[model samples]
Target: MAVTSNKQGAAMQLCMALPENFRRQDFLAFHRRDADQLSEHVTEDSLLKGVVWQGQPACLSLFFTERNVSVTLDADTAWSADGQRTLEAWVGHMLGLTQPVAHFEQRFAADPVVGSLLQRQAGLRVPQSASAFEAVAWAIIGQQISVSVAIAVRRKLIQHASLLHASGLYCHPDAQTVAGMDEEQLKALGFSRSKAVALLGVARNEELVALLAQPVATAEQAEAVSSRLLAVKGIGPWTVSYALLRGFGWLDGSLHGDVAVRRNLQQLLQRPEKLSDKETAEWLRAFSPWRALMAAHLWAQQSSAGY
Candidate 1:
């Protein structure tokens, strides 16, 4: 991946190539699903989001076209050459540009259920968050709640713990920021006491996030990450799977525990009722190494079906 950067005053401007299969519409649509729409902003052909950059609050903007993207970082100080490259790579990862899904399309073209989705939603990649901690926190917040409600709680948490960028966008709180808050504070923000404890536990666990951020290239590696996450109190299979998918762009995490996944599976299979989570897990095992992508297809199918 080639990157070019220019520092103009307080902003770092960058130009990076987009993958051929990159679907701008899908990317924007995926982010637009964020019910909160607080820290992240999405437009027809661009994205603007606040993130903790180099341990400081910053806002990154990306204007997308067919073949390439232009990025602007709003920060207090100009980034060094290395920082610029790191930021560029992070932006690429966050946009899912770093993930190649052609193999998935090729491998599943003959699959009856997913083949059609692959054709319909070609170029779809799991969009990642700014950090693993952010993804984990979202997973915790979203557990057993409606997306809108979870988003509202998340917005409140951001307002309580986050800093605003010059662009007036609030940066999602980093682990240190969230960890510093008392459990009662998070609970006051609508987090259940259990969730508050879990979030705080994960946030204070500095090494866990670092371990999860590493590239997961194999089943063994993914399992190791899962083991570490599961060992944490209040972290479960669904939470770990979601964090892996949305945080590390890991493609194989089984999402059978997801309600929407099971509901869509019931519809797709023409069943009278949604499959139990255990049944869904069994069915999803057939698509190992691509279950998460299959889950993505099911989610897209749900949206298209107006479910």
Candidate 2:
């Protein structure tokens, strides 16, 4: 085994507020990796193997490949000059940099579970937005299954429909690709009867994206979006919450159906039973718009555990 960081790129300013060109060789077992393929597919022609972290674009260690794995950021347009700089700058922008960083400090300071996970712990990386299609698809795949299997299925989806190189950099598939998938093709790829149907149903529905882009100014706006999202077949509360936090950037809600999360908390408190949705909800209500980050931290704990 070997470690290398010898790639040459432009000398752009790395935001002091974010992570850059980093990868934990042990990250895979730590959080079990995002088996559902959370990398951003922001365009039809490009596949973003990175994510929007603190509004900055960040990627895994893949400097040797030809098809750059960097997400472009900081430019006026969606496209970036270098995937590295663009991704970083853009992610920082999405994180609402204008708001005082103190806002986050204050929020985390007020909550022990979330704040402790951030300040005192390591191994978690949160994204700015979740791919709506990916989250719902993941929720459907993981409805009654183990996290490992769900990740396997998602890996197949990416290999079949996404772009990647031998170097291990993968580009997430956009909704349009999923929306246009032929029925037989997906079935052949292991999409269960119900998940396949539900995935296509939501994919073809243009209204989902339209509504997601609206101004979520009030509780009513958030509630309306949540309700409409849940109405879709194969999409339920856990799925909806994942989408809101990962896709829509509404990070205050906790993911209910994640087996790993239940396990982590159970292990932490030495609880007698797995957490029920009601208990999970009560626990998360205090986070108020940062549940996504909270979830990320829990997942990271599992990651660091060598699970």
Candidate 3:
């Protein structure tokens, strides 16, 4: 919780700290997937654009140090205490500030592959999207498609549907905005009809939104939420698992049938073939409650050395 304030007339600047073991470079690297998409919104200096609080948009620059992360805001912005709190919560969710890594460290202390990864990437946290809606939207958009294609489609959707902030940044569209989009509009953006329908369905489901809005504090609670999400028309086990990990910040589950996870596991074990889904699950169970973190570490294997 690194929050500082300075006032000059009507202008204010605020700063916040990165949590323990958190590395700014690692975070930025993880989000830097494509130059044409959301990753572009995160700049080299770690200045993130289109941060919306209470429906107002602002640009935030994050400066990293050995001990803390400092946040600087636009000079004209004056955030209230409540607004600041909201911003803090949003940053926490995005950076995984509240996630504990000690359990994982202890659990993997004697293991080989995961232990090495845990040691190598001590402060690496599983970053989440700004909101559950954004996470679910991304899941639906990414279903059965290559990551690059999904990002392209998502960028198109954002270009068309997102709100442009006065700061020249675009805020991701909410459920209502996406739900209002017609099938042809989505198809033009490369969304399959089924995916478009699922996106619209999720956006229109108030009950689902309300359910995700509640705090998920335990594995059981997260599982229940996953069950409800799976009940939706196009939401599958993989999507629900992904939403739980990335949207709800649950550390209890992994991307159960993800090919990347299997590939990573196979590579870690020095196996000639990818692990079967059952084998992946059985092996991943060793990570237990922190399997999501394990998945993040596995994902990091293909990423830059920042981890």
Candidate 4:
């Protein structure tokens, strides 16, 4: 990818070329729903408010075209050599730019269901959270709840705990911020007692966050991280798997107990009832190393059909 950096007075802008098959609309679909909480959508640009290393607040407005993505930041500090590298890494992670899309497409070419889904929604990517801590917190908050309600509660938590950037955008709260929040305040914002305690438990344990933040380039590495996360209270298989997929970008990960996955599977397989855990595991294994991307495709399929 080609990167160009330019400074216009106080504003810093960087442009990077996307992959050959990158589709901006497909990437935006995954993030558009959370616009109110972590980002703002204006026309074709998605404005991301985030904090860099050492808790430096930064705002990035991403504009996408067929071949490239342009990021305009409000602060000049983020344009420095080190800052630019950090920003590029973060953007690549968020957009799943490093994923082996061609390999997955080749693997799914003969599969009936995933192949059909891929044909319908080409160049779809699994969008990730800005931070692993945020992914874990959202996983806990979403347990046994609908997506809409989880988003509502998350927005409330952000409003209460996050700081506003100088650019007038709200940055997502770090683990430290959530750890310091009162349980009563979180409960008032619609967090269950268990979820509140779980969030705090994750936040207070710096080691857990560090472990979750580790790079998982192989199945064994991903499983090690999953096992460590499972040791945390209130974190289950579903949560760990989901976190591995969304937080660590583990391609082999699958949300085995996900309701949406089960529902989508039932609909796709023409089953009268929800698939059992064993059955879900068997079906998900069909995609093997690309199960996470398969899950994203299922979600995109359902969303497009207005399910």
Candidate 5:
């Protein structure tokens, strides 16, 4: 990573090379789902978002070139070289640059179901959250609600709990911030009592927080994390799976319970109706260790079906 700075220590830019077959349009479209521009700002050519660095707010501006993505961090204070490397690593993780999509493609290119998606979507990868806290909290907030409503409620939560950066963007709150929030405060932001409790429960629990922060590098580790998360109140299979996918970039999460995944799968198979969650789970078993990637493909398939 080559680093460049123009504002002395207050700003720095690092360029990361994009892999061959990287799906730029799909990645940008995924980021565009933040319609309200609360946590992230996305344009046709670039993305601007905020992050918390060493207990301070910072802005990340990402500009894509033909071969590389340039990430520029702007902050009020200077950070050590190690701190800067940490931020660069976080940005790479969030952008899905570290995911092994190539290996997935190599393994599934001849399979049914998702094989065409591998060919069509090419280098599609899972975009992770800045932190595990954001992923789990988002999954809880989205439970039993439409995506649009969930996005709106998430914006509300960020507005209420996040810190404002010098660049006028709100950084998503960390676990400690959310844990410190009162249930009534979240309720006032349109979260149901149950969701408020659930979000707080995950955030406040020390064991859960530590587990969330753990590096999930293997299937066994991922499963252990899922088991622990499911034991928490207000978290279910769907929530645990979703959190694992978004937070840890664990690719095997079975999202058969997701309505859109089932509906899109029906369309993919030309079935008369969406499969039941059980049937969907059974069908997805063939794609073990890559089911979440299949889900992402299904989502992309659904998003482009209108045209």
Candidate 6:
């Protein structure tokens, strides 16, 4: 087992939520529950460990495989409290795993047809993750980069986002802070023009502010609310879908266009021919909500293949 510590500091009261609609075992299974690669995260300061962000009141969500559940942010340090945290882990789990049709029929409701379809197919789903501010920030840092490289960039971005001490872990930057950052600063940090532009543009978008203003509940409304994010300048189908899975708690979204996903699917399908978008869509359709889980499973496989 790994020791646990918070980089930001001691926390306020943490209200952890794991929705009844979501299954913890199903969710962990999707991520493979692989501790070797995920251990550093037990300490909040590690690059590959937790997901940190600065919203109205600066929050952090860290994943500790040592404990089978993804823990809520311990917001203590300089960060104060809001009212209550909204996890919708159930919704996130819905979007993160791939399951059999029968299994999903039992778990997810039918009001959202696509989500239900996905649930029936995929066992789990990945949540959309962060709001636009955090999504674009992460997306920019991760663009055209390897996992290690992206993790390094995230470290720098987090450093730029706040005043770090104690253990050198910092909160993700606020939109205003990032908005004021110059392209030259980003360039000096090896950020590509496209990535810098996208990140900065996100920092300036008023819609990001609007999103921050809202209370994040779950993916119950993702099928409708996702469109608002998709309309953003830097956001696209993949980005929105990513957010829906991690952020909005989308249960059934898949990223067929993703390079990693495409490569992984190629290995999984082992078809006579290369996969087209249409064919990929068809092939992935069977996985539905579990497509995200399949994705995680495939990612772990691909990642281990190199070793």
* Model 5 per-residue lDDT tens digits across residues 8-85: 468777777777666666666666777788768888778888777656888889898877888888877766767657
Lowest lDDT sum, 10 consecutive residues, model 4, at 45-54
Query: Candidates ranked by TM-score, best first?
Result: 1, 5, 4, 3, 2, 6
lDDT of 3 by residue, 180-252 (tens): 8888898998989888888887878888877777767787788778887877888898788778877878887
Candidate 1, 158-219: lDDT as tens digits = 89976888888898898888879998899899999989989988888878767756767678
Query: What's each prediction's TM-score?
Result: 0.93, 0.64, 0.88, 0.90, 0.92, 0.61
**Which of the numbered candidates is closest to the native, going by highest lDDT?**
1
- Which candidate, 3 or 5, has the higher lDDT? 5
**lDDT of the candidates, in the order given:** 0.82, 0.53, 0.72, 0.74, 0.81, 0.49
Give the residue spans of candidate 5 off by over 4 A: 1-7, 76-78, 304-307
lDDT of 4 by residue, 1-307 (tens): 7888777765677898898777666556655656464644545545455543346565767888778889876663534657666667777887789888778887787777667767777767677777787778878888899888988888888788757677666666787777788889999999999888888878888887777667778888887777777777778988887787777777777766788888888887789987987788888888888887777777765773111
Model 4 misplaced regions, further than 4 Å? 7-12, 35-39, 50-53, 75-80, 304-307
With a 3 Å backbone cut-off (N, CA, C), the pairs that clash in candidate 3 are 2-16, 2-17, 21-123
Candidate 1: count of backbone clashes, pairs at least 3 residues apart or interchain: 0
Error of 2 at 249 (Å): 2.4
Better of 1 and 6 by lDDT: 1
Give lDDT for model 1. Answer: 0.82
Better of 2 and 4 by lDDT: 4
Candidate 2 deviant stretches above 4 angstroms? 1-90, 93-118, 122-125, 128-130, 162-170, 212-221, 304-307
The root-mean-square deviation over C-alpha atoms between each candidate and the true structure, in angstroms, is: 2.2, 8.4, 2.9, 2.5, 2.6, 7.7
